[model samples]
Target: MHYQITLAREVFCEGVGLHSGKPATVKILPAPENTGIVFIRTDLTDRPRIEAVAENVTTTLRATTISKGNIRIFTIEHLLSALHVYGVDNCYIEVNGEEPPVQDGCSAYFFAVLQKAGKKIQNKFRKEVVIDKIYRIDDGERFIIALPYDKFRISFTSLNEHPLIGTQYADFIVTEDVYAKDIAPARTIAYEKEIKHLQDMGLGLGGSLENVIVYNDAGWINKLRFNDELVRHKILDVIGDLRLTGGIVKGHFIAVKSGHQLNTELAKEIRQGGC
Candidate 1:
């Protein structure tokens, strides 16, 4: 009996892309039922559209990127995370650049934007992918598993050699209020040693202490919103990546150091399996 939902009205925001280091403006507009979450590159002449679905995911270098032919958008996980938690089933995300605004490198700002716009229930029933059994995706060093559960939840383990962030774990039921308070404020993180290398690779160009949590061997360069913010941010990314499944997923996700690649792969598998 669950129904599709969209924004009650259109809303807009503007900021710099985390990796692109370019200013961008985004508009979130209500869409018809079943439209799902779609992105439009309004800066282009053709105004190409790319649906945020698993099959459209073209890359996961440092962030998830969905593409249609030559048009592409990256660093979308933060916004998508908020949308997933808000149960936004249909919307059109129009952007003038290749990525959405980084916005403190977390879902908090996006979540607030959703709050301002409000939600409207559509007539059609929501499309949901309920896990019936276990589904697993394993890489030698990282893994993600989905198990049948009545509610959407996540259990994540983050392992790092850094003394400050050695190993952290957290489990949470993915509710909008829980996400806003616990998950959305955890900013993206990076090590000081990796910054130069990442920049050399033409990434993280827009990153700063304001939007990213930076750490070195000594300690964190900035205060943490939560003691175990790293793991909680991992869970946030998982929620966002899995939203590419094109429907709301009902399951418990257990992950160990899983990133966008494995997250989207699991989404693709679930979608292809018709589960």
Candidate 2:
């Protein structure tokens, strides 16, 4: 039987936050079995620990997670995605700012950290929420649905407005090799127009041509690893968001133009103890 796991030792890294534009440091430490994923704000006047769960999600505007008292940590999807794929059941994350550093704008860095720190299996059996029936919700053009499946699978279709990223679809089954080799390194991307708009809204302040794929009418200023990287990134995002279930999920999820909002909504619906 599968068991809960945590890192064997603490790992540390630093990078710039995708949204806050602030340089931050993070320490990923092991936690006892069943402790779940918790975020501690080490830089705040009061050190507050924020549990990583759907209910504590305070913001989704361009990738942000906050606790009940407004304590937050941003740009956590990549790291969260990595943890879910690796089957790590619990962790203690300490950050020195409001957001996690966007190291290379992908989970590659975090994956490396986990590799170096290693993992220790706990005695408790890992808990999982197996989907019993279809659960779905939609908002305008965006939607998501979950159906019963033995393995975690994600399928996404994105209608990107940028010329370089028109329409694309990507599919993946959650596995260590699949996630680390296929999805973890797939960098986050944004259109040139969206970059300026986000900056105007005081977001994506740390965004640069180096951290993300910038597209324009002429095409990407840099090379793309996959033709449908936009869609794969969406799949990556949804994987991390659905992890808000606070346990391994056994199901298949289908999505179209879905973001954090729809992702968490579906999790909330399931948490209400419904089918």
Task: Assess candidate 1 and give its TM-score to the true structure.
Answer: 0.99
Per-model lDDT = 0.94, 0.84
Error of 1 at 96 (Å): 0.3
Model 2, runs deviating above 4 Å: none
User: Given candidate 2, what's the lDDT at residue 236?
Assistant: 81
Q: Which parts of model 1 are misplaced by more than 4 Å?
A: none
Q: How many backbone collisions does model 1 have? A: 0
Instruction: Name every residue pair that clashes in candidate 2.
Output: 74-99
Pull out the clashing pairs in model 1. none
Evaluated with TM-score, which candidate comes out highest? Answer: 1
TM-score, model 2 to reference? 0.96
